[model samples]
Target: MSEPTGVLTLRLAGPLQSWGAASRFARRATERAPTKSGVLGLLAAAQGRDRSADLSDLAALRFAVRLDQPGTRVRDFQTAHHADTGKSMPVSERFYLSDAVFVAAVEGDRDLIGILHAAVRSPVYLPFLGRRSCPPSRPVDLRAHPSGLWKALEAEPWQASTWVQRSRARERRVELEVIADLSAGDGPGDAVRDQPLSFDPRHRRYGLRSVHSRAVTVANPLSAPRRAFVPTQHDPMGLLED
Candidate 1:
């Protein structure tokens, strides 16, 4: 298979994005950065995959993002009162989720693009732009990028920003917009398919790491071009592997 090239843009913004860090209790929450695992979970949902699968395919892909702005952090305190005295008790520490927007771009094999398209079309689970509770304001299709991914995200026509800001006074966060371009090989067979690209283990923490902050054009360095993959009924999940 030949290397493919294209861009995958993700816009993350909402009143809350729970990226569990050191979560211990059923309702336990943590205050930390976004983790790669958490971001992958969102992607899996977009593809409709509820259970974990081999993410090796994504390992080869180059991921980058621009943090439009910083985010606000707030903690919700919980506590119980004395049973005999029935007095007010001290509040326990439960962190409220942070709010921010992320713009990400992925450039790799064309086969990867096909798989992503399929994931969005008939996701195994309810896909969300960032969090399950915060569904995308628009259909998450790259074709909707005539105005660019950043524009699409800003056009969500929802009050997500308002809610995010109102959650906490000290929660003053930043707003960022991203623009990415990708190029991959048009290879044959499934050689590039299901192969893991660069996968971020930190995604479960502070969201996807910001790689290559400065915008740079990507080039495909393959001499022999490969053919793109054609979908088959028996191989519905095969795309995810690529």
Candidate 2:
């Protein structure tokens, strides 16, 4: 496989994030992590690109997601009446990841990735997690890296919440899970139909994409015992100990 020239990292941290690839009417489901189609859509939205825009260029890029902090799955209920029927509609069962944090990376040419990175930082259209109702809690743009999407995902630090990070700090080693686009020679994984052919709502289309799961270990950045600072005046024994 060819090495990636550039990479764009996105911090997908939100109170309630939904990235459903196979969602149908009245039932919306979410994937464990962000989808490639969803991330591309986000980039396009940031660039103010319309749905009819040709995404072939964007879709060609490799995508990967790091499970920084797997949040709890919550089922939400909502009711919406038909537009023309004007009658009660079935309550939509929307699934979301509450307090989830993921690090998604895209590897591609510098020109394209650079444009996307800029758009992420300064999106023309407001960015949302998946649906418009589920906006990200913080900025999605993490930063840029020089490695490919897979390597970047492996190398990036844990993006979990402060509490989660602190809790993990007690551990001697931290292992993170990552799902990335599988190459020709890579190991096999479950097939998923998420590659977006087009974003046209009228006739949306998708293609099958293969992904493989793997784990990488990183030294805990915060694996240090917590300490409370004591003022010399408050602790006369501190001077004696010194």
Candidate 3:
């Protein structure tokens, strides 16, 4: 079986990130990690591909993402009054993740991957999370991986923030989950409702796609720190006195 020789790796970390799967009116939700559509849309923005442009080619690339850190979910209430109607609008709950991080990989033709990587480095149009309101906090481009999506995602180091990394590094090892696009013979995975049909705002559409998930335990991806935290299960010394 032939596969793309290169995969584009990206660090999707930011103060606030949101990837909506099934958001309804007055209630905006988000996925734990970046979605295929969201990532691909970022690429398109890098290449300056308009919303009406052809996405079939970009969508063909194999997609995968590893959850380095599942940020905390926060909700904000939004209130507005209708333009025509003189009634106050319902309070909308907008959700966002704070200090989230993810390593997203796209496997495709080497040349294509290279181009996408460059686009990310210097995007033609600004790249946002899932919505324009949630802009990325840091650079999105990591580098190009000359391997399969799974290998790249697994090999890449944890992308959590420094403080978060230190907190987890005290444990010395962390288990991360990987979700990748699949057809058959790739083991069992959940079908996600993120496959993009059309990104048209007027007629947005979505479909289901298969994704396999697996846990990978790796040594603390962060390097040596000044101090390591030791969280013991039992209070050997009984430091807390009644």
Candidate 4:
């Protein structure tokens, strides 16, 4: 008999988040959606794993994320000086998504999922959105789901901010995007170089993985009733007085 599997979901929301898969040198870039390697790194951090710790087990978990609120992409410049030499360092350009909210899920063994669920609530190290400076706005752990990745994502309610939810409620139904890993024997989806191999700072490495994207529609909980329109009298002549 084989062990049953479960899904663990996380809410990644903050004022600022930066998930860079290809950042290098003095420039730091971020992907529109959260990366698999980045989410696993967060899990490793929750378990108090070191940078050089073994990640073979964590790498095997299937990953997926839903963009509850695809926030705006913004850039900023940073200036600093080297401490040891007292010399000014090159200005760095960094990009981040402001006011973003995402739902990340990983399907794996039930025991491991349970362990991770506990670790997140009382993480050894506090969880951050994507960078050390950008911490999460809410609790990351959404608990474990009995269903797999897709169902779990679909079942999870919209996690956008109240303002965003109200703005979106104009539509009766809203569609949210989902990006998920392709399993074996699946069709060739888009390939991305964000899979984690090792997190060793000296020699960090990543492999290629295929991901497929789709959208799921959910009824707007804040959908407001349509208001009847009434014409105001003499509004056209009011501009002449100004």
> How well does each candidate superpose onto the true structure, as a TM-score?
0.47, 0.88, 0.85, 0.90
Give the whole-model CA lDDT for all candidates, comma-separated: 0.46, 0.86, 0.84, 0.92
For model 3, state the Cα shift of residue 96 in Å.
Answer: 1.2
Query: What ordering of candidates by lDDT runs from best to worst?
Result: 4, 2, 3, 1
Candidate 3, residue 46: CA error in Å? 1.4
Tens-place lDDT digits, model 4, residues 52-156: 999988999999999999999999999999899989999999999999999999999999999889999999999987799899999999979985788898788
lDDT of 1 by residue, 1-242 (tens): 64536556555555555555446653556333344444555566667543445565554555444443236666666778899999977665665445655444444566675676567666677655333545654344432233233344443332234444344334233233332222243222211111223333533222222222232222222223446898766956777994
Ranking by TM-score: 4, 2, 3, 1
| Poorest stretch of ten by lDDT in candidate 4 | 233-242
Model 1 scores a C-alpha lDDT of: 0.46
Model 2, backbone clash pairs (residues 3+ apart or across chains), number = 0
Q: lDDT of candidate 2?
A: 0.86
| Candidate 4 Cα errors over 4 Å, as ranges | 184-186, 225-242
Measured over all alpha carbons after superposition, the RMSD of each candidate to the real structure, in angstroms, is 21.5, 5.9, 6.4, 5.3
Candidate 3 residues 1-242, lDDT tens each? 77447999988888889898889999999887889999998899899987888788788888988888888998889899989987999899999988888888888888888888889888899889888888888888888988777778768877777887777655677889877897679777788888887888788888898988877665686646557788879976788666
Give candidate 3's error at residue 41 in angstroms: 1.2
lDDT score, candidate 4: 0.92
Clashing pairs in 3: none
Best by lDDT: 4
